[model samples]
Target: MSDIEMIRAARARIAGNLRRTPLLSAPALDAIAGRRVLLKAECLQVTGSFKARGGWSAVSAIAPEVRARGVIAFSSGNHAQGVAHAAREHGVPAVILMPQDAPKAKIDGTRALGAEVVLFDRERDDRDAMGAALAEERGLTLIKPFDDALVVAGQGTLGLELAEQANEHGVTSAEVLVCCGGGGLSSGVALALEAEAPGLRVRTCEPEGFDDVARSLAAGEIRRNDRLSGSICDAIVTPQPGNLTFPILRRLCGPGLAVSEDEVLRAMALAFRHLRVVIEPGGAVSLAAALFRPEALTGETAIAVATGGNVDAALYARALSTLE
Candidate 1:
């Protein structure tokens, strides 16, 4: 649904508001992957994830009068913080509907950013229904986490940066692995690369049981995950790929890749130990696939997007202990 032009405009609109996260590599990582590995360190981006790009893009694109009326979104954690932060910066009110079971750090972080937090049960409550009710009551604009055009356009900016950075590193051709949930980030990046760096292809990465995008890609249609709450990689879990995002992914992306929970923890540990960057489980899936599923990759080089670093302290400590 998002074109390169919209992505470029998003980059322009969100300029100076988000970090141009770097592409990092460590010899240790390369050794594990058995190929040249480049990690797009989006974990270091504002709000500790790449979600800020879409948040800013969606919120800023709202008409000033409408924006002042406020904005609302539903996210487990990363997207909540992103939307909350953007709303705070624009002096607008934000109400975020977050899963009651989301990491405490994310809920607290969203509140710290000045958004009103509403908690809902992931399984029983329909977040979409709740959000719509709230939006109507408060006159709040809904900024969908991944399904909206502007949000997808905003996420596409990451692909633009990746294209430029890959060129700088002499990586004209490589598989760019992205941690995917409802396909927003992956689809956006796929579109951007299709236009800017046709040689750099995108591959959707997910935790094993929740490989909806991967299954959908293989099936040539959207597929829904049977369950949503079990994976430690909660940040990237969703019911299915976005209707808007799946077509782009099916059109442009390579086969989807899935990694186990153990692989995800190990990838997080490896990221901290080797890259000196902290990565949450959901954010580490791309790196997990690159490191542990090398046989599934076709390219001589791999670029994995480390999407977030919002892990709870205890969970982080547990991940680090795995290496010990």
Candidate 2:
């Protein structure tokens, strides 16, 4: 179990660097969900995503000697930028392995933060194995995107902020919908909510067909996705949940919800038009579930964490055109 102390330490360590993203209220979203809807706009966070929280936590916690050799990480987009930005802040070199087809915006963003970018063929290459080998060869510390304790703890800081903000609004019992990839964010939030607001329910939302966490929780075992590169929600398309994160999620989170790509596009369009936020498909899944899956939500207060805003302009325009 993840203790609140770990999250407290993580918060303290990364507080100065990370943006304390606001909890925003949207009347249009509330009307669609038939509930009081609040958005944890993590899209507005540093690196345009919440992954920076974990990246800073992990990198800063490294032993000074190890950090001197620098760090390496594997991510689709958001985590790449997170690690790169964190490494830059620590004055360390970072090598990031990303999918060759990952959104151009994310790749450019990571490079702009001064990390060396290595592109891999997503369909043919094993990112984990490649990242491990590269780390070993360079004698660099590997930042396991979700599996590391420090990373999970860092991600949990979002939960701390959300819980406190929700309580400030007089929300006693609410349901938090999180976008699930390797269960890092979902499980981290679950652990924090468990300690901060026991009354709140944590639910995960994933892209359909990539809903490994949902099936794993249902079967009480770790599950793997059948394919790796099918979804538009590329940010959350991990083969399976992290070993460390799954247990926390299984114990603390409610049943998972899966949304289709079409639903995700619709949600992204709605976000652009009403919220004035540019949301990637992966980041829109939780909001999609909140808008479309009312039965899974537990309370009148539905708070969805919009995880990223790294969509390419062409893709964003195409998705918006679907609204017509």
Candidate 3:
């Protein structure tokens, strides 16, 4: 787990390289929810997701000599692009192990960033084992998607930004809805909010079948998803809560909420139509919770972090069709 000090340092380290994504307001969302809802459009961040923060933080923290040896990461998509992008910026080699079924855009994006792409079957192969073997064979550093302190600290920078932006918007208290996978972003933001925006409460949101974080919180222990091969929210389909992220979430975040696949699709379309933002299904989960599960929140001010925008054409088209 990461503390506020680590997050502050990460913010300083990556400040020059990252975009300060805006805190946006949408009247349509407000009308639907009947409250002040702010959207933290992290979908606009570098590599079209917040994963860049963690990737940069981990890569930049590496010793110059170690970085020369290269880095490795296993992700569904966003984190692969993030690590690849960060490695590219530092002139370091990156080898990414990704699911064979990961979004084509993400696979191409990672390759375009100059990383060696290794794809494995999600149903039969173990990504972690493959990544570890490759790292050992090549003397590469494994940058985990959500379980590292460096990555979590880096992700917490969003919480710092959110606190500052909410203050600027005159929001003293709010319920922040973050799409949860293995709890990297949610737990990191939870820690940051606990220190910086004490008035803001963190809530993890997930697709209905993949709501391990929510279930874990409710059960007072870490929980695992029964199956990982079914969700359209590929960006957040981890099998279980991360070892490091789970404790932070359990301590700092409130009971989580979940939304159906249809709700996630509707939220994606709503983001495009009302907020004028392109969002993936996983990225739209928090927004779905905000729009459809308002009763789960307790504050007058609500903010949802739209975490990514890397949807494939087919899924984006389907989401767009929801409005029609």
Candidate 4:
């Protein structure tokens, strides 16, 4: 199917199955910008993140027999929850592979969604390798968290909604800022935004560690940096950019910007106190870019994708305390 067609099908597939979340506007958020800022609060989405949009869309698109064998997923955080939550709805068994260092909350939450969880030592052994081995051994269909076309299209549905919602809410066009890891969400968001609201500029926000896109865009070549990319904002901590996703984003996105961990935490706090949104470090990243790098979006009304809200309980407490 064509890319637009895939997004259309995903929208239909997920309709009534997911929340028709708001394209929320706030005078407070507007105050941040001389113009205005609209927050697509995907943080409030199912499993507390936008990953659900792609996860449900991709898994459901699979053949019945394929889904019957259940699914295997590799993630450090939010996508794991997305996969597990979607698998639960289909009565499919799921095996999730995660870095042993992944937050305890995500590991537990994945299991809470009724998916079996396994841990790999990301420091010594490769998580992807472990996941591939497990998938082959268990007869599970590996659900690539970002690389899959179905997942990308599924993620694109958000852009479609943003476009439709913007027209309805008096936001005809705006700068779209999305957090990035492997670029699944950013790629889909950019494609959907352009198709839905042509001429939209999409900006990708990344942490310093996995900031490959920013480097590559600057150098005009792929560069890998597996170093620690800020804190446990598991949403955008991809070790490297995806081969399929990078080209699309390079063509679509205006430019990628990186934010510090402090900026991310502070942005997370702002969303909690002002926007009444609870986002993990990764999910709040796009907003972090906005808060710290407004020059990148100078002279435009902006829409930031508040991607996920799956902060560990302890981290949530710490954020709340910092805000207070």
Best by lDDT: 1
Of 1 and 2, the candidate ahead on TM-score is: 1
TM-score of 4: 0.95
Model 1 lDDT at residue 115: 95
Arranged by TM-score with the best first, the candidates are 1, 3, 2, 4
How does model 1 fare in lDDT?
0.95
Question: Highest TM-score, which number?
Answer: 1
Residues 269-319, candidate 2: write the lDDT tens digits: 988888888889999999999998887777788888999999999989988
- For residues 75-156, could you state the per-residue lDDT of candidate 1 as single tens digits? 9999999999999999999999999989998999999999999999998998889999999999999999999999999999
* Per-residue lDDT of model 3, residues 268-299, tens digit only: 99988887999999999989988888777776
Global lDDT of each model? Answer: 0.95, 0.90, 0.92, 0.81
Candidate 3 weakest lDDT stretch, 10 residues: 293-302
In model 4, the Cα lDDT at residue 212 comes to 81
RMSD after CA superposition, every candidate: 0.7, 1.1, 0.8, 1.7
Runs off by more than 4 Å, candidate 1? none
**Collision pairs in model 3:** none
Q: Report how far residue 171 has shifted in candidate 2, in Å.
A: 0.7
* Clashes in predicted model 3: 0
Question: Alpha carbon lDDT of residue 6, candidate 1?
Answer: 99
lDDT of 4 at 237: 73
lDDT of 2 at 278: 82
TM-scores for the candidates? 0.99, 0.97, 0.98, 0.95
